[model samples]
Target: MENYHLTHEDGKYKLTKENGERASKVFESNKDEAIKSSKDFIQNQGGGSLKIHKNDGGFQEERTYPRANDPKKSKG
Candidate 1:
């Protein structure tokens, strides 16, 4: 599994996956507002989640990791 990063820029936002494929588009107004709107768009697609954090430098969202199977445990 891999993580992706979404960033806010001038009049638009950017999405970059771990594989390095990037997609960007222009929004109407503020960058932060655009980012939140984009997040909503993604969540509406299906069972998805997103979180925004304000770091010392700027805001960021950390993607969640799926649970892995454990072979050491026997079936009950």
Candidate 2:
């Protein structure tokens, strides 16, 4: 599954998937709603990671869906 990223830009919230350069979805002045939708999209795609970024390109937070769905696993 491709990764999803939520970012705040141009006074709007945008959700972008790894496969595309343009935003896959955009929210009008609502970061919370955009984030929720981004997570739902990743979860629907059989699980993936979501990364939230600040306006200045700083890392905010990351969430991984369903541990089992992560492609990389640590050796026990």
Question: TM-score for each prediction?
Answer: 0.40, 0.73
Alpha-carbon deviation at 7 in model 1, angstroms: 1.3
lDDT values, one for every candidate = 0.45, 0.78
Instruction: Please give, for residues 11-41, the per-residue lDDT of candidate 2 as tens digits.
Output: 8878887677899788885667777787777
Number of backbone-clashing residue pairs for each candidate, in the order shown: 0, 0
Question: Residue 11 in model 2: shift from native, Å?
Answer: 1.0
In candidate 2, stretches whose alpha carbon ends up further than 4 angstroms from where it belongs are 67-76
Model 1 Cα lDDT, one tens digit per residue, 12-46: 45554435655533356565676566555554443
At residue 66, give the lDDT of candidate 1: 25
Candidate 1 whole-model C-alpha lDDT, 0 to 1: 0.45
lDDT (Cα, 0-100) at 59 in candidate 1 = 53
lDDT of 2 at 34: 76
